[model samples]
Target: MLHIWGRISSINVKKVVWTAQELGLNFQRTDAGGLFGIVKTPEYVRLNPNSTVPVIEDDDFVLWESNVIVRYLCAKHSAGQMYPTDLRARFDAERWMDWQQTTLNPASRPGFWQLIRTPAEQRNAAVIAESNAAVESLMATLDRHLAQRTYMAGEHFSMADIPLACEVHRWFGLPQPRQSRPNLERWYAGIRARQASKGVLDLALS
Candidate 1:
């Protein structure tokens, strides 16, 4: 059996959980991080030095980093399906996953924290505005790319969509002025319709 350590509310944890469900892998998830506070303990630190929510123990093989875990699961289970067998196709999926972490996530974090995590009294309007603009610009890039494809990598849903979809859920759930991006909207709708996305992507934003 696969043992996963994380709190469900974590976006990163949600990525692993969704991938597990998509692959139909039986996994046992233990709550950690945030209010749980187990991540600071010695045992948890040994599992993930970053003190993050998601740490998976697949037999004796321990893995951290949510995107890597998702990729590992897909490679070990789904292969040509979620992992993508072709060289160019695999890199395409990898590229989008990297973009979510390096580009989209940083652009969206301030807005998410200001609007969703912070109290109204402490929220910074300037930060919110700036972050929103940055995020919107990044989303516009995605909108253009999605205009010709059903999923991030290509025609079929792949591991590429998981992290970005999680990021999108956070941004979209926030109370903000959003410009019309027809293609992004359509792609998100399609993701929401997946049965595998149920407990992960379909949940209320934390």
Candidate 2:
């Protein structure tokens, strides 16, 4: 049996969880990272030196990094669908995954930390405001892309949707409604309708 270590609320963990559901792969998940505090243990560190929340052990194979997990799942299970058979199509999926890691994360983390993670009195108003503004602008780009297609890569929903979908959920769950990006809302609503989406990405904020 495959074993996974991560806290559900962590977006990276949610990516792997959602992928597993999409693949219909059965696995056991253990609570680690965040309040669970297992990542620092020598045992957990042996699997993932970075002490990341998501570490998967399958047979003798050990894999960490959320995006890599998503890719591996798609390749192993949804070969022609999520992973894509065409080289160009696969790169398209990979590109969006990288975009989420590079662009959306940096733009959204400050606001997420201040608004959701940090205590009210300890919040940085300036940083929160700036992050909010940055996310709004970044979301517009997503909105325009989504306006053209049902999913990030194209009409077919692929692994590309997984990482970006998690970020979009965070934006939607934020205090202020991002009314400026109606297309993004429409796209997110579609993903939220999926059973796997409900299972993995719909977790309550910590």
Top of the candidates by TM-score: 1
Per-candidate TM equals 0.98, 0.97
lDDT of 1 by residue, 14-133 (tens): 999999998898999999999999999999999999999799999999999999999999999989999999999999999999999999998898888888899999999999999999
Alpha-carbon deviation at 80 in model 1, angstroms: 0.8
Model 2 scores a C-alpha lDDT of: 0.89
For candidate 2, lDDT tens digit of each residue in 1-206? 77889988998999999999888889999999989998999988999999988999988999999999999989988998989999999999899999999999999999998989988999999998899889888888898989999999999999999999998888778776555678888888889999887767677676
> lDDT scores for all predictions?
0.93, 0.89
lDDT computed for candidate 1:
0.93
Flag regions of model 2 displaced more than 4 Å. none
